[model samples]
Target: MNVTLRTPRFILRQPQVGDAEPIARFLNDFAVSGNLARVPFPYHLSDAKAWLRTRVPGLPVENSNFAIELPGEGLAGHVGFHPGPQGPVLGYWLGQPFWNRGIMTEAVIASLDWFFSASQAPAVYSGVFHFNAASLAIQTKLGFTQTGRSTLLCLARGAEVEHIDTIMTRSVWKARPK
Candidate 1:
């Protein structure tokens, strides 16, 4: 996989050894910890290293995980796609300090472009918790349409939750203004 994706103000790259300390710090922030289901509160450098070294290397061909970094500003967050039976599943998160800055949306657009160009997949899907309005808005802005709702058992959150599933197809994406 390519190591990096450059956007106007961000670099979406694979996680490296140098990223461990900053990622650990961001993961432990209360604001970031509360919103994400997988990241533990009080996250440690060991956890970051484990995530980068073990989990990241095993991602499949259809999937990609990127560490969002703003040079001179530090690690901003992460974004990725998980290939599913139906299509690719998109996921992303931004550090609290980077919120409301449109960074994630830009990253998503770039990822979508890469997916369409590189893969055979025809569509991309994203699921946002009902209360995550910012995420919903981002997907909508990227031209995804609400396809359905799903009730998922989130073991990490310890709840049966409702999520709005949105989808964007290659046809739709290709028709959009570039």
Candidate 2:
């Protein structure tokens, strides 16, 4: 089932149609969308609506997705896992206003805590475009280690970009700081 995770300052819950407005607004900025592999730049309300349609509820936590909400700010962004060639991949993005405030870091820790506790997967895979040093730093703080590099299509940039692959094994996550 789609799980709802709560942190001291944020709520991680399922995405809904109402979240489309903020999703489009935040992702429309190239600074935000360009770092993401799947989102297109100039992201529109219709695009968010279409993507939200795919977030089927009642799916297991492994396949579930979350809309990151600040207490009074509505949808701040998203963090969730989806199927990848190797295993479940962690993916997330935040509105520019919410950047650098440790919002994503808190949400990610909560999500990973729940994910590792609920599932038996050996590891979770994630990566950032090579230029996204900020994102890479967050990954590093969470004990995710670089696995390799590969070129991946960045829809917003409309070209291939270098991606630094990383993985967090169960043991590392189990030993993470609380």
Output the number of the TM-score-best candidate: 2
Question: Which runs in model 1 stand beyond 4 Å of their true positions?
Answer: 40-42, 55-59
TM-score of each: 0.87, 0.97
Range of the 10 consecutive residues with the lowest summed lDDT in candidate 2: 56-65
Q: For residues 34-131, could you state the per-residue lDDT of candidate 2 as single tens digits? A: 99999998899999999999888667766768899998788998999988999999999999999999999998998998899888999999999999
Model 2 clashing residue pairs (backbone): none
All candidates' lDDT scores?
0.80, 0.92
Winner by lDDT? 2
